[model samples]
Target: MAVKKKLAVLFIVDLIIIWFSIYSAYYFRFEGKLVEPYVNQMFLYCAISSVLCGACMAYFGMYRKMWQYASISEMFAMCQAVAIGWALSYAAASVLSEVRVPLAVAVRTLETSLLLVGGVRVIWRVIRLRQSSGMDKRIPTLIYGAGDCGALVAREFKGAAMADHKLIGFVDDARDKLHLTIHGLPVLGNRTDLSTLVEVFKIKEIIIAIPSVPRSQVSEIINLCMASGVQIKIIPAINDLIKGKISVNAIRNVDVEDLLGRDPVHADLQGIADYVHNKVVLVTGAGGSIGSELCRQVASFAPDKLLLLGHGENSIYTIEMELKHKYPGMLFEPIIADIQDRKRIEEVFDTYRPQVVFHAAAHKHVPLMEKNPAEAVKNNVFGTQNVADCADKYGTERFVLVSSDKAVNPTSVMGATKRIAEMYVQSLNASSRTRFASVRFGNVLGSRGSVIPAFKAQIARGGPVTVTDPQMVRYFMTIPEAVQLVIQAGAISQGGEIFILDMGEPVQILKLAEDLIRLSGYEPYIDIPIHFTGIREGEKLFEELLTAEEGATKTQHARIYIGKPEVIQQEDLYVELQKLNNVVLGNSEDLKDVIVQLVPLFARVS
Candidate 1:
């Protein structure tokens, strides 16, 4: 109802403007003296022109436009409508009357009509913008980049009804763009002048709009902004924008992963599809972080059937519902069975015969595994053996074990068990038809029991976040990134290869804690006290991806490397594994001694 009323009012106002414009043109063209035929024909001319103009404007949807956000396109549209209306008026006047209208009068009327119609819309737009600017409490913002992205962001801030940011200016490195204006905002200076501009404009936030640049450059810009103590946000990449996954309102806070400054991982899509497409893929521990991500990526390839196998019913159900919602047409089967139960696992394999298996089930907590070595053995070592044996027996095409960096020069029982699992898989690859490999990397940022989660929980409780050792450092990667490389590794697997991901530089745990505190909008060591606790049992100061014995060789993918350690003979490995299995079930006190014997590098903390 309100829109109809608005349109009616707009039509009436335009009619009035049209009538006045025609009369003024006649008065001006006659040189301030309205003579016989001109004065006599003025009312008839006004009526005919007004009706023609109204019809043209209505046909062109001129009244339907919201002039508050009008642009050059709207102005052009109005001009076209006025021109058509004037042409029709002159034709009608020539046909209906014996007296011909002067050419100057017709041309003057066309010009005057266009000027009145176009000018009102533009003025309305400017007035609305000024009124909105006065009413809105906009935050002073600095846009980093003077290209298309920067200009789009500025326009969005100005015209978006819900936008709360007021763009002060742009900061670009292009020499020629400096001091130039975009969308009425000047390119104040380059990034080097960011600090000064922040002070000059009292900038409360900085939006980095250049998504095509490398991560290293983005990190550098973020560092500069951090120094000024202003909040930072980033635009999503071009690909995301093109896919309709992001918009101006989709801008988000910078994550810790962005600080790594590593280039985005480009996976071998053809290789991944060759193995995953139209194949039954099973991922054990499919409810866990890495396992769930593997399922998602596998589904993207349109697998014949994705088998989500996990021990926990809730997690399995959760991922199942999510996949169903995301890929409603894709087929999936969710199975709940513990890998430690050999009979159950073998039965599942017999039924499905999945061509590819990603084994991610294991006890990952160091301190917990240190206290419960037998449980770790049953789950990590024997659990892996059960899965690998089934894959071999069922003629599975590929088996990828998700290993960890702690397996190298191990200090913890969790690490030792992972190393033992790697050994068993490598040994099985010798005689098995299934191509077996392992992907070993370090901590995932948001995985369960990782340091980041612990720190966040501590910070939430308003207590001192604890650090085991001031020097402790470990390699880290985002969960999705790590899973992508893992899938790629599985695709390119020959046999018995341990693929180590190039997790950029190691991050100090203490520094991570401090950064998390700050990111949570708190001052480190001031708002939240950080306490240094001595290293716990089964913990180390640093982690290694490869030991001295197992040197790395490069692969086709720059981020993945192959490490071929000295393999244990299958017969000998099975014999040792049998004895270890008996010890695990019998509750012997020599558990650590047996583990140390198998993994010579294993050291038990006293």
Candidate 2:
């Protein structure tokens, strides 16, 4: 109803403007000395022109636009509508009149009408902008990039009336752009001057708008911004911007992963698609972080069927629903059976007959597994055996076991079990037709039982984020990146190769804690105290990707490497595994010794 009333008012106003323009045109043409016939002609033309112009404007959707946000497009539409209306009016006047209207009069009328219509919208838009700017409580902010992305962000702030930010200026590293002005905001200085500018301008926020730059550079800028103690936000990446997903609201806080300084993983999309496309794929532990991501990536390739097998029904059901929602036509089976249950696992294998299998289910937590060595062996070792044997029996195409860097010179039962699983699968590849391989990498940033969640929880509670050891360091990768490389490893597998991902530089646990605290807007050991707890049982000071026995060799992908570990005899390993399985059932105190017998590098920590 309000919109209708607005349109009515616009129609009446436009009609009045049309009449005034025509009258002024005639008065100017005749020098305010119009004769009787001319006056009659003027009245006829004004009435006809008013109706024609109103119809033209309405048809052009002039009244539908919110004048407050009127722009060049609206002005262009006004010009077209006025020109068409004038032409139609002249035609009607020429056809119906005994006397012809002068071309000068028609031309002058059009000029006046277009000017009035277009000018009014521009003035209204300016008035609205001024009003909004006056009323808005905009925080004084600095944009860190003076490039195209920075310009767009500035425009968004100005054009979006609801935006609660006032851009102070821009800061760019490009020497040419150092002193230039962008969208009325000056490029005050480069990043080096960021801290000084923040103080000088009283900036409450710093928006990093260089989305195309490396994350390492962004992290450096973030660290500099942290010095100012101001709120920081970043624009979405170039791809997100190109997709039209970027907006003022799309800006988000810098996550910990952003500080990793890791380059974006560029996987061979065609290769992955070729491997998983139209194939029956099965992912164990589909509810866990890495496993769930594996399922999602595999499903993207239009697989004939995806089997999400996990011990936990809820996680399996959750991924299943998500996949169903994402790929409605794609088939998915959610199985809730523990991998340790050999009978159930074999039954699932026999039923699904999955061509490719991603064996990710295992006991991975270090401290917890140290206490429950037998359970870790049962799940990580025997459970893997069950799946491997089933895959072998069913003539599966490829079997990839998700191994860990902790498996190298393992200290904990968890690591030992993972090593045994890797060995067993590698040995099984010798006799089985299935291409068995293991993809080894280190800590996934936000996986279950990772330190990130624990640190975040401690920080959220407002105190003392505990670190196991100050000097402890471990390789970290994003779960998605790890999963992508894992799949790529499977696609390129010859069999029995342990593919290791190049997890960049190891991050110190203490520094990680400090950075997390800073990112959370708290000072390490000042606002939020960080306490160092001695390293837990079965924990290592540093993690290794390859042991002395397992020398590294490059693969087709630079980031992935093959570990050339000595091949153990499949028969001998099986005999030892059977003994270990029997010993686990009984309360054997020599479980660590038995693990050492299998994995000579296993260190017994009391």
Candidate 3:
């Protein structure tokens, strides 16, 4: 507190020195030892000007900040004070008839005022340099970009509490900015200097501010920084920035979820709440990511009763506990039962009598599902059928089947099974009062089995981030965002509706790996090796949200679109499914043939 008071006093002294300099410089410029009878009034004018300048400085918050390590806004504040002082001096020295003043003298006074007032800030800056010269600054950091974000980062490091982390300049992809100074920090070359910079400067952290840069590029930088032993973090997306949540203090570690390859798709909170508000809702597979998200979202809609159904007891208990904690007043029943057991599902439907049901139970991993095609068929196909049929039988108002993007002309057994689930819902809708909908989307980023966790695990292990194929691409949406869409889609459901979400553009898998590496603060090739292991079975080069023959018609909601599939006879589908079930159970040799018959274009495990 004493040091602060001394600094404040020093600031006032500097301002006074500037004020007198302006007064004396003008006095000399006029080339006169004032002999006028009203000369004493000039001292009065100086006094008034000094007080007014001080008042202006206060208004601009100049005194609140350290002027020696002042901000650009502070400099602008100084400029304002000087300009106002000159205007006031002009009025005092010349405008009043009682005052003996010349226009030429007033001009000199204005010129000198600017020089002195501006000089105070200039001198203060110099004093800081002198004060800081002998101090051994230790903390080292790397700013990611060479552009405006980099400059903002540099400026922040110059401000309060930034002393712990010394700015070691930028690591940019653009070669043109090499050796350039951004707020006194040099653009120390390209990303190639990452490891070297950390080693040379003993860099402890890297702050990435390139929000608009591709996730792939951002990942590259994070990997570089992380590999170099520098902690890597990024600025939040534009939304967080616009909300003023972004700051040096707000800097956070780079999340592996960012490599999911799409911006957050904003959810329809009201639209979702409208459907689930005070209504009974139940979610199968409530322990799984998609199911868990559905449960959380439904609970937010103020559902009177939320039933959490899953085969895994621990998972069901976990979700039930979480839902209980989050929504104290709401009813949550955690039921542990496999969907394959129709009796258990029927009993749950009878007990809950839920108005809305989200069936998300399924084996989703493509390769795993390929290995256990019968299991995929049983869980994804039969499990969904059992749930949807139970909902229809129980007179549930609506049922939403969680479908996948690979369901669109799917080549994988998992995708085909999910597609079969969609077909079952469509067929079930035809025979029942329940309005069933299938929300088809691609991958949910950060989901239990998603690539994001895999990449994160690999990165955490040090090296060799694996990529199935450099060219592979997939549509991705955040789990929350996807759930939001599913909610809205369920609300807008009509019988037999297959709702497809807008997944934005697909992102390259190889690029995702690269970006994940970068986010970890490692150079892609130099520090973290991205091993391309070739495309896996059931892995598509690019995933589609809709089948080629299917087209989406706009619904009440912008994000949800209705998918029109090739017309199929419900009787025929049921008969075919029965045969598929028998074949899966009896003739394991005919499993591939049965899968292909049920889901055309379904590739058998090679």
Count of residue pairs whose backbone atoms collide, per candidate: 0, 0, 23
lDDT of 3 by residue, 195-298 (tens): 88778877788888888777666655665666676677778664445433346765778775654445555566776777789888889899999999889878
Which is the better candidate, 2 or 3, if ranked by lDDT? 2
Q: Rank order by lDDT, top first?
A: 2, 1, 3
Which residue pairs collide, candidate 2?
A: none
Model 1 C-alpha lDDT per residue in residues 1-606, reported as the tens digit of each score: 887887788788788887887788888888889888777566777788888988999898898888887877978888888889889988887666557777888887887777777777777788988998677687889999988887777777866652667778899999999899998889999988988999988898999999889988887887678767788888857664553234666677877777767788899999999999999999999999889998988999999999999989999999999999999999999999999999999999999999999999888999999899899999999999999999999999999999999999999999999999999999889899999999999999999888888998999999699999899998999998999999999999999999999999898998788767766767787889999999999999999999998999999999999996686987877788888988998999889888887899998777
Q: Scored by Cα lDDT, where does model 2 land?
A: 0.89
Ranking by TM-score: 2, 1, 3
TM-score, model 1 to reference = 0.76
Reference-based lDDT, residue 149, model 2: 87
- Name the TM-score of candidate 2: 0.77
- List the RMSD of every prediction in angstroms: 9.9, 10.9, 12.2
Cα error, candidate 1, residue 125 (Å): 21
Off by over 4 Å in 2: 1-137, 243-245
Off by over 4 Å in 3: 1-163, 167-232, 237-249, 256-263
Candidate lDDT values, in order: 0.88, 0.89, 0.78
Residue 552 C-alpha lDDT in model 2: 91
Q: Highest TM-score among the candidates is held by which one?
A: 2
